[model samples]
Target: MKDRLFEKPLEKQFEFDEEVAAVFDDMIERSVPFYRQNLDLIVTLLLRFLKPGMRVVDLGSSTGLLLIELARRCGVEVEFIGIDNAPAMVELARKKSRALEADVTFLCEDLMRYDFGGADVVVANYTLQFIRPAVRGKTVQKIYDALKEGGLFVCSEKVLMEDKWLNKQIIDIYYDYKKGQGYSETEIMRKREALENVLIPYTIEENRSMMKEAGFSAVDTLFQWGNFATMVARKRGK
Candidate 1:
């Protein structure tokens, strides 16, 4: 199904409910610029670092598409875990994994409180931005603490530009991009209004600073396209 979720009046703030979960795969591919390319980049980078028996966790894993792809391509015995707060998403993810016979565990739990255990790679694709700014740092810290020495944290987010005018221009361009992807003007505006205080984004610098503060030894952008970016941070203690 296409993302007509915002075509009608929203009853409440944007959330990962059944409606959203049902169409999330389609929505993300169309709404996010270079979504597939970003995932491929993440998989390739992770493959370089991951070893047999290493564990990979994907925060806010949605329908488990990334995990499925990773499992299919890694060609090694690696643990794949996906965590999401939405039961609907978790259920759908579980179902898909079963259908594909992919070795993935999907858990429905609050990410902030979940025990991350020791992981070689943790990914939060477009997930951290939804977390409140005040506690985002703490969440990153938890991820850092949960990683093994030299572990990697891959985060992808929609970022705001520091320049106010440039920020507005970029947003307009993004809206136009959505329009080109078949989203109507009214649907775009409605979705924006519903996500007003819900989907808060930070600047790229601020995101890097947060990761550094959380004790990541190094951080760098792996990929970027206007407002969207994927960052990699490494914990450097062996």
Candidate 2:
């Protein structure tokens, strides 16, 4: 299914419902800036760090395509678990995983209260932004606590700039990029309206600050385009 969801006027705010689940793969690749490239970077990083029997968890795993592909390519017997709050998304992800016999587990649960059980590598691509601002820091802390010593956390998010002028310029450039991806101006505007307040973004600095406070000894950005960025955080060995 293609992303014709926003082609018509939205009946409700954005959500990971059954309807969106049908076209999410197409929607993400076309809506997000450098989405494919960022995912490739994540794959490379995961390949480098994955070890036998290690637990790798993905927050908001969506369709679980990333883990499925990684399972197909990965040589190690690492545990791959994907957590999602949306039942529809989880169902689709499990369906896809079962089709390929991908060694991945899809769980429908809120990440905020989920137990990670000492995971070695945790990923949250375009996930944290949806969390409420008041408790976002606590969520990062939970993620940090879930990891083992010397664990790795990779996160990708849409960031906001404090500078109003530069912010508008970046958004303009991003809109142009979306247009290049084949979205009509009306589609774009309608989608923006749907995502308003539903998708809250933070500054890159704010994200880094949360990681640092969460006990990640090192946090560095690995990729960026317009307002989107991928950051890697490392926990120190005790």
Candidate 3:
């Protein structure tokens, strides 16, 4: 695991630490209904190929939400490793993982530096966008190399859309939804700026091409909501 990934920078990534935690907690507790409404569509499309006892890695796992769902609710006995760069987030996630009794571990390591030697399922839920574009290809290749033959890589992300009108509409609706969930406009702008400063999001087609270049076979979108999408790709069985 790369220690430098956890090197904290001086700039404030979040305005208030407690507020950040509150936002995350509210999202988890109150947003379950929204997630449950879409879980079957997303999970079925992403995990249909997965089997029991396969080791999985959750890259950029925040609060360990998806991994817990996969382990406790999905009935998979796979050992899970959840990696994130935020120490505070990792601590919270570790506590949750312990409380849930899920087969999971949390590591405060950079996704770019982590050695993924035995991953069977690699998940990056809204996290890969933070990777620098120049190194993104190498990161995907690392994921490909880390996987055993026929392993699955699933990612859900907010992407850059090509159509100008559609892109504006997507951003509008996304923030509108966020506002409806009780975030102030100031808070929403701050969140957007923070993400923009960190994440180098790509177009859907660009991501597909990158995955293919990284040696993934059968890359395809499993679910899409405007700019947000879920995709699954497979490593070729040798």
Predictions in order: lDDT:
0.93, 0.92, 0.73
Residues 1-238, model 1: lDDT tens digits = 7888988987898899999999999999999999999899898888888899899999999999899999978888999999999999999999999998899999999988889879989999999999998899999999999999999999999999999999999999999999999999999988989889989999999999999999999999999988999999999977
Which segments of model 1 are wrong by more than 4 Å? Answer: none
TM-score of each: 0.98, 0.97, 0.83
Which residue pairs collide in model 3, if any? none
lDDT of 3 by residue, 88-197 (tens): 77888888888988767889898877786888889887777777788888888999999999988887767888998989998888778766766567766665565556
Ranking by lDDT: 1, 2, 3
How far in Å is the alpha carbon of 199 misplaced in model 1? 0.7
Descending-TM-score candidate ranking: 1, 2, 3
Q: RMSD, model 3, all Cα superposed?
A: 5.8
Candidates 1 and 3 compared by lDDT, better number: 1
Candidate 2 stretches greater than 4 Å from native: none
Clash counts per candidate, in order, are: 0, 0, 0
